[model samples]
Target: MKYKIVNINDTGVRSVLIIYTGGTFGMIQDASGSLAPFNFGKVVDRVPELRQLDIKLTVISFPKPIDSSNIGIQDWKDMSYIIEENYAQYDAFVILHGTDTMAYSASMLSYMLEGLNKPIIFTGAQMPIGSIRSDARENLIAALEIASAHNNGNPIISEVCVYFNYLLLRGSRSQKLRSSTFAAFESENYPVLAEAGIEIEFNYAALKPHDENAQLNVINNLDANVTILKIFPGITEHSVKSILSDPQIKGVVLESFGSGNTMNFDWFIDCLIKAIEGGKIILNVSQCIGGEVEQGRYETSKKLNEIGVLSGGDITTEAAVTKMMFLLGSVEDVNEVKKKLTYSLAGEMDMMEE
Candidate 1:
């Protein structure tokens, strides 16, 4: 895919590549007063403060920007490809994506790009950049600064992260919890990696360790034959059966009630058992925003453990789904996929205490 590059700041200590993926961050209104992707070539004109950052800025925008709602596996591949091709040239990357699916993209990239040693900060806005009160300028500026931040020649943030509002969260741990506010993302089960205020206060203890010797490996083969089945109070047997019985589905992210509890009804257990027997790797993740999936902590969830349903401890559904896709497509062995599903591949989940 061809990209249009726009140079913002030419001289600085560090260079940051701003990936302009279609989002509200680069939007403006037309004469008809409808929001659309603006000509990102003039991004410097919209957010002039970029000139003030001490980092050389270059933007690579998609030839035809798309809404985050339309982002799919191909988009993820494109983003990864861009990073892989430019890995050695740039010190950091700032991805301007729509907040709606920014968490998903970030989580997916965390798994796809292994052994990353530079910051890949994802940021977006709640309103168009054309709006007088839009948060786009602040978010972009902070993200760029955080991306270029380093100490003694080592990058401060060496993993995928989402910088929104004033919080910097691990990409895999973040979820878009709000729809209409600038504070649209949160990491309920993990600590904020950094906070932007008078200055960026980084939680060094929360940052993921990086291996400087390791090279970036981009895994592009993602299997999309995975789906989520959320259990509700009155979820029907038919619903369970239909979802589990899909022939094309290879993995299922079971969004179980608090702490992985599910109905103990014979039909429900039978459906789960049947799915497991059919060689479907089911990952049990909690539906709650802040809790974990304790597969056998209670009698309600004990059956899941007995049936070989894997526990996704404190993992967001977005991460669980993308992890499944990453494992299923990249790993040829189903047993290996099941093993990796329960472990933290890219610091996506907490390690279960044995």
Candidate 2:
């Protein structure tokens, strides 16, 4: 069944700001035989479904919308700035972003907007919204609805999240799982915070509560001096040594094998040890799509645990990168940064059961 937005003209009408940051969702075929972003103000009128929602939506397009692939740390800062500048003016925010880097952007925003008390829903389409069979309309309409949904005069979700298909996932835990399917993202470690079926079902316990008294803080400074090292069966000592020896690098994410297992070679262990001693923060994250990083669970990973490599239990790569950046940017003390990496900030990690 096709999803349609239901209009509500009661006193509870919500006002939302839709930031169009260019993606397939806003593209249309131009006369020159190329796809370009049309004005969203005009684009919205074509979608009759939007009017049904009865919410006041304000479209704020970027000077030139960027593809999600080109999104970088600066883009994240800009998005945060926009929200911070207009925080009290809108009830919720809906970011129309591209799917390629949407998860990463969402995760970064989750950290940037710490202590958030309003809904920030990031969503985009697999197909262009102008297409006859586009997934854009449903995704956009539902995202706005979710953003506007409140309980007892307060917003339901107070954290950054991605709404795709029918599920609302914590941004830090979401990953794009499919290239072709409409159900493109999955939160492997965390359950759905909310689901949109015949009726929107919200797991209230799973939702991040709002603290109205806490002042909203926006963290824009992000350090990108981080590297990701993936371990392989026949990786050479030279490759591992070189990566660890980089003088400018501040952090490393070791994507080890199942259960965070790595090579038991002495040289490999020594390289990691030296890097850590040189003030480089190293975190061990599992290569598996849906498992925790147990550094000491196996003989191969025991050395990593002994040497004080941080454990990233079931956190996605997107979250690992942004979390490192956020921590590195905010804290000058390396030891304190290491401690926070292991802690569950913003529901990014699952607590290991004793």
Candidate 3:
């Protein structure tokens, strides 16, 4: 995929590549007064303050803008490819994406770009950039600043992150918790990596260590056959069976109740047992806001452990689902995949050894 550089200048300074994927931040109203995507070729025109920063800026926009809801595995691959191709050319990457699937994209990339040591910040706006009062300017400015931020001659934040509304959170650990509010994202089980106040205050203790030697290796083979099976009261056995019985499915993220508790019904346990025996990886993740999946924590969850369900400790559902896709495509052995599911590969989960 060929990408044109919009406003790149001398490499003597910190440079950030602004990846413009279609989102509200790039939308404007037409003569009919309906919101539509605006041409991002002049992105600096929309957010002129970008020119004031002590950094060189370049843009790579998608030929056809993609709304976040329509994002899929292919989009993830494309984004990775862009980063990999331009890894050495840019100091950082700031992806302008729709809020709907921003968390999912960020979570997926954390696993895909293993050993990445450069800042990759994803941000977008709740309202169009053309709106009388929009949050787009602040989000873009903060994200770009964080992307170019450095310390002691190395990048301060060297991992995948989502920067929105003044908070910087680990990509995989973040979740879009609200729909209508400015604070649309949250890292409930984990602390924010940094907060944008008078200046960007980075929590050095919370940053993930990087492998400088590994560079940017993008894993493109993501298995999309995984799904989340959230357990709710009176969820029919047939519904569970239909989900677990799919032969093509290699993994399932079971969104169990508080701390991985679920109905201890014999049929439910049997279905999970059958799936495990069939070589399907059943990942037990909590449905609660701030908790881990501790299989067998209570009587209801004990059967899950006995039946070979792997626990996902303090992992968000978004992380669990995307990580499952990454593992299912990468690992050939079911047992090895199960083991990796319980551990934190890219700081997706805060796993405590049992």
lDDT of each: 0.92, 0.87, 0.88
Q: What order do you get sorting by TM-score, best first?
A: 1, 3, 2
Backbone collisions counted per model: 0, 0, 1
lDDT tens digits, residue span 317-345, model 1: 99999999999999999988898888888
- Lowest summed-lDDT stretch of 10 residues in model 2? 1-10
Query: What's the TM-score of each model vs. the native?
Result: 0.98, 0.94, 0.97
Q: How big is the positional error of residue 149 in model 1, measured in Å on the Cα after superposition?
A: 0.6
lDDT of 2 by residue, 169-203 (tens): 99989999998899999998888999999999999
**Model 2 residue 342 distance off true place after TM-score fit, in angstroms:** 0.5
lDDT: the better of candidates 2 and 3: 3
Better of 1 and 3 by TM-score: 1
Q: Scored by Cα lDDT, where does model 3 land?
A: 0.88
On lDDT, the stronger of 1 and 3 is 1
